[model samples]
Structures are given as C-alpha cells and as structure tokens.
Target: MVKLRLKRYGRKGQVTYRIVAMNNLSRRDGKAIEELGFYNPRTNESSLNVANIKRRIEQGAQPTNTVRYILAKANVL
Candidate 1:
C-alpha cells in the first residue's frame, strides 16, 4: 500500500520533514516514491505541491494523521 507520510531530515535538534509518498512497509526515513512537500515544526511552515497531492490521493494514497492535519490546515483537504 502506498502512503503519504513524512521523512525526517536535517540536523539532530533542528529536524525538518519531507512529505513523501512511500510504501507503507518501509522505514520512516526510507526511500520514497515521490516527494510531495515539506514541513518545519519549529516554524510551523509547510510548502506543498497541491496538484500532485490531489492526484496521489485520488489514486489511493492515504495520508497519515499528521499529514491530514497539515492538509486541512492548508485547506487542501
């Protein structure tokens, strides 16, 4: 199953996340099928590819709880 999730990156205490489309069984930081957006918790900032996100969701990609919140906050869901 394909899932829309976050992949952690950046330095130890300054971590950021890349929103990604990846296989459900993969590790949290594993390779992804596609990168969909970005998020920074420290600043509550996010940038998304709206078109691709809608496309993937329509094709059966399920977003995780956190991603769902972000999408809703961005008025994309």
Candidate 2:
C-alpha cells in the first residue's frame, strides 16, 4: 500500500519534514516515491505541490494523521 507521510530530516533539535508519497511498510525516513511538499514546525510553515498531492490522493495515497492535520491547515484537501 502507498501512503502520504512525513520524511524526517535536518539537525537533532531542529528537524524539518518533507511530505512524500511512500510505501506503507517503509521506515519513517526511507526512500520516497515522490516529494509532494514540505513542513517546518518551528516556523509553522508548509509548502505544498497542490497538483501532485491531489493526483496522489486521487490515486489512493492515505495520509498519516499528522499529515492530514497539516494538509487541513493548508486547506489542501
């Protein structure tokens, strides 16, 4: 199954994340099928690729709870 989830990155205390389309069984920071957006918690900032995200969602990419929240905040759903 494919899922839309966050891929962790950055330094220890300043981690940022990339929203990606990935396989369900992969690790949190594993390889991604495609990068759809970005999230920076420290600044509450999100950068989204609307067309790609919408296409993936239409193709059955399930977002994690956190990703869902972020998307809602961005009004991308």
Candidate 3:
C-alpha cells in the first residue's frame, strides 16, 4: 500500500517535514516515491504540488491524518 505521509528532516528541536508518497511499510524518513510538498511547523508554512497530490490521491494514496488537516487548511481537500 502507498501512503501520503511526512518525512522528517532538519536538526533537533527544529525539525521540518517533507510531504512524500511512500510505501506503507517503509520506515519514517526512508526513501520516498515522490516528494509532493513540505511543511515547516516552526513557521506554520507549507508548500504543495497540488496537481500531483490530487493525482496521487486519485490513484489510491491515502494521506495521513496530519496531512489531511494540512490539505484542508490549504483548501485542497
């Protein structure tokens, strides 16, 4: 199964996330099939590849809960 989820990055206490399409069994921060966007919690900033995200979702990628909220906030859901 493929899932749309966050990939952790950056240093301690200042972590950032990349919204990526990855296999369900893959470890967090493992290889991604594609990087769809990013989120910076410290700044509450996000950037998305809307078209690609839609496509992936249409193709059966399930977004995690946090990603779903972010997408809703962006009005992309």
* Per-model TM values vs. the true structure: 0.99, 0.97, 0.98
Candidate 2 local lDDT, 11-68, one digit each (tens): 9999999999999999999999999999999999999999999999999999999999
TM-score (C-alpha, index-matched) for candidate 3: 0.98
Regions of model 3 farther than 4 Å from truth: none
Of the pair 1 and 2, which is ahead by TM-score? Answer: 1
Stretches of candidate 2 exceeding 4 Å from the true structure: none
Task: Write candidate 1's Cα lDDT for 38-62 as tens digits.
Answer: 9999999999999999999999999
| CA-lDDT, candidates in order | 0.98, 0.95, 0.98
What lDDT does model 1 reach? 0.98
Q: By TM-score, highest first, what's the ranking? A: 1, 3, 2
Please give, for residues 1-77, the per-residue lDDT of candidate 3 as tens digits: 99999999999999999999999999998999999999999999999999999999999999999999999999999
- Which residue segments of model 1 deviate by more than 4 Å? none
